[model samples]
Target: MTQQGGTWPDDSETVPLDSGSAPASFVPKSTARRAQSTRPMPQRVGAGAQSYPDTSQFPAQPVSASAQGGAYSNGAQYRQYQQNRQYPQYQQYPQNPQYQQNQQYSNGWQYQQYPQYQQVPAAAPAVAAAPKRTHTRKSPKHGFLALLMWLATAGIVCIMAIREIPFGIDGSRWVPLIAGFVPWLAIASALFLLLSLLWHRRLLAVVSLVCLIFQVVWHIGFFVPTTSLSDEAKQAVTQTDANGLPISTDKYARIMTFNTTTGKADVNAIINEVREQHVEVLCLQEMTEGFVQRLEAAGIDNVLPYHIVAELHHGDNGGCNGIWSLSPMQNVSGDLVEVDASRVAAATITLGDSQVRFVSVHPSSPTRGNQGIWGEGLSSLSSLKEYDHTYVLMGDFNATWDHANFRNILGSRFVDSSQQSGGGFHMTYPANSKIPPLIEIDHIVHDKGVVVGDMQTVELAGSDHRALLATLEAQ
Candidate 1:
């Protein structure tokens, strides 16, 4: 077939799709420009297609014969098309302007172009590699430590479990109070871990919640206020002396008990706390001779005139117990019993028409062999009972209210001031510590004759033992 563009047709060359049409320039100048402007101009391909008038400027096609399996012989248009098909991103502009499909050419010939190739769009960006999850490889010995920690946790739980049985000695005594929060913490951790593992398990969630609620309810059932406020209010209303008249609380006494660590904490801070609270009777444990000297030197005797300090003779650090009073004290002496006795100091004070005996007892702590000593100290206090006079026993007993000896022995005769006043869970001793205290060992025990009112814990600076204050009124 003959070519309509400026040349006779070559059998090997690609013919126009509509070979009968004239070239792009054969149109009116404005129409030709409009056709050219129909789309954005492309970037330069190798060079302009050969103008037939300038056929000498044509570029040689990169041709290969058996160069590789993908190569072609004779530079066949179909073979070149096959190779060019691999890069589909590059578009091949068709011969004869696309807009000329409806237009009829008058007469002039149009030039044919060589093949052109350009990137119509850039190569699609490779998908970004997903971020890798970071993981820390624990040391082999960490497993051993974790196992030991778990064993310790289990052991504590066991001790608290049989606390009432006394199977583990001191660990079993008053330990259930410490167990209240442990199971709750463990349950919370387990629920979170289980959620990560079995998020869709409704039974597990329900069981975990039930267990948590049961533990909380169980603790509340045991440690909740045993003393009835209604009964206390009735007692307060009905309370009378031998004369059958209402006893006046206007004439009251504020007593405070604090363990001072044998002058380890700032004595000035303790003194300031006592003075700020306007304490009438102040008792201190771990009160040594040096502490007494320091106190007297610090003008404590001026504020608290009546002072009776016992001398410690137990362990090396076993300091004495002292009672400082605002009013005149009588029969003030140390409870120097046979075993674990030097830690007690007793005195008597008169408020209104009533005379109340105040005893400051600091029994041995429950550490190793000290349990027996603690028991002995407790037993000794149990013997010093007199129904004739009202008694106020206040100090660090070194035994929580949950102790068998405390409930069975001490509870047999006297009432805990905290229970009577509805003072819930006032854990004293081991103060100035970052870790929360577990149990209440410090107490203000009083005979039924003495009316116990609001009791509070005073946080003393620089001391490991918190100060306990209990309000007293005559009954």
Candidate 2:
């Protein structure tokens, strides 16, 4: 057989060879191409595959070794084809020119080379945070309570000021009347001060404190002793007079003054007090003829035989005044106080070698339409200071120490026996009444030269005024 194109011709011709060799088989080239087409195509898988042509359009099928030639018969040509079908070497992708250089983007999506953001640690869970607390508003009641406390404090301060300064504003009668209740007012101010502190009111507390301080400084002396005195010295009686009454060679005398409520007082109570206290001089206001008769019948004369009673007219009511003394007494009613003589009974008595003029005074009360008369009567007593003798003025003046008019009557020469004795406050008026006595309208006032001791008050039935007793000695 002849060879053409390096392939054996398919003419069914046979070539003689050496004896004893078997016949060899050959696969035609067209059949070999059809077999190769049915095999699976190998696909390249990365950027390197872009340069190769795709062979996926060919259908795949399985081929057996018998259908194709055995592998060793065409191994050299098959290895040459494998070497030609190798995929292109892998290459890196090309970068876009726009992305190569830094540029700003209008759409806010440009790939900019920003500075590296610091890596933040993971946050703890929200459950780890503390919860918030809600607050409630204050009620209006608290504000209203504070307001009432402030108003009370203000009122207390005003009252204390009025009592202390004694402005006597508008010439109003209420000025003197309000002054009488200053002690109670001071107590109210203290209560207000405590309330202000509890309520946390700064202004109210300050005002209350100031007012309380003023009251304590001004009135504390009334309750606390200003002078010290021994019990024996206060009650010392050096001698007895011929009338069996107590007297002292040092010119000491025990005296008492009482208003009998228009002769309604129990005469036995007054007599017993005078006897027990050994009072040398007893002055009486609102004296009546019937009261004088009752006192005489009660044997008041046995203890104090000397007496000078103002003559009472038939219609005199209870305007008369009288004085009874253990020692001899001379009437000085006209010589001592000529004004309101009927209401003021004056007498001079000898104590040891000294002469003491005693006056039982009853001033018109400061009732409505009577303030003028009351003032005149209190002013009239000021003339007593002009006398050279030691004077002891006692009885119901219808005025308290708080009254500006009463203090003026005291002047510089005279002082209240209660105050001079350091006996503190002794309220003596409105006795034997539903309400206890709240003011010291009955007082014993003497010259400053007189040494006063052991001032006291006694309550007697049926009398509106208490009996004020004081021990006096001439200096």
Candidate 3:
């Protein structure tokens, strides 16, 4: 190999090189002699050996003859040399079990074996289940319907309580006038309570239940039977004849009371009803002179022969009253009551050996600013309870059991025939109007000694009120 201009020889040159005599420019002048004697020259092992620069000055490293196809021509010697040339720091680490086997490179380079990896199976795709369906009841308009029902029930209960106040204390004619419809109010309260429950309103249902309970407790008497019959009255009712028919008894009497509606009620119907029912006593209110003539023409005298009629006073407003009896009647009085004399007629009727005082009653209605006169008329009848006679009072009292004034007339001595017979809610007023009768102003009232077997109201044509009929037995 030749050096030109201080440059080293070419690596492709195949010449015996001496490392001891290197270029003077690359080696320092001071250490040149010492380096030459101590460092050995790198020698080519074969003809195919690569020419490399001598690294003897660093340290003598064993050469791999396999790198140049020298002593280890089959690669065994080169692999042994590589295994022995491991670094001291890395020698403490054990060889990986996977690398225990040797691997040959394409260029004859041996290396540690690497473990083959197996692919892991992918996870199954996630799946979700469908949700379950459930049925739910929908609330009625979010309790709005129940709220309305509760309000209605509450209003009815409140109105009924207000209307029950006596006319004398409250001084409201309208309140007392509508008092007869209290039974309907009680019914409506119960109906609203049921509706509130159906609508699923918790608060409204509770309130409506309370209102229903109050109304039922307050007005239960009107629906339930309260009358108790005496022993003599029971015997008279249960007594039968040999032919398996009820025997006619003088102790029993069929009484009917009607308001003629200022002579507008059908006279023929009234006569037919008295004849068919075998009425013993017939009391008539708003009895005009012309109405009496019509009754006579309709054969009312044949049914009830004995009679007493009151004369209508000025501004009476069809207040004239009359009474007719099948039996003989005497000791008649028209001025016994303290109110207008024309409004009431009283007489004594002979029933077998016993005598019964009968009165036809007609009071001024609390309409058209006649509240004061109406109250006075009802109040005057309170005196009748003080009398010793067993009285039978029947006609248009223009009041109901709800009226404090009318109840005062009863005064523990008299009982209404409808109540005595357990006839519930016998509405008899406004019978022939556009609206069905809502109040019972006409009634048959008798002394406590009398027992009522049956009581009912009959529809009368051409009249605003129905006729009340009662079967009474004297105890």
Clash counts for all predictions: 1, 0, 1
Candidate 2 lDDT by residue in tens digits, 443-473: 8888765666777889998888889887776
Report how far off residue 23 is in candidate 2 (Å): 62
TM-score of each: 0.53, 0.66, 0.66
For candidate 2, give the lDDT of residue 371: 62
Mark the regions of model 3 whose C-alpha exceeds 4 Å error after superposition.
1-142, 163-167, 228-249
CA lDDT, every prediction?
0.58, 0.66, 0.67
The window of 10 residues in a row where model 2 has the poorest summed lDDT is 85-94
Q: Is candidate 1 or candidate 3 better by lDDT?
A: 3
- TM-score for predicted model 2 compared with the true structure: 0.66
User: Relative to the unseen true structure, what is the C-alpha lDDT of residue 437 in candidate 3, on a scale of 0 to 100?
Assistant: 84
- Tens-place lDDT per residue, model 1, 224-343, is 544433344334434454643333343466678888776675778766765665567888887777877877887777557788877668472368888888778887777634336455
The better-scoring model by lDDT among 2 and 3 is 3
The whole-model C-alpha lDDT of candidate 3 against the native structure comes to: 0.67
Ranking by lDDT: 3, 2, 1
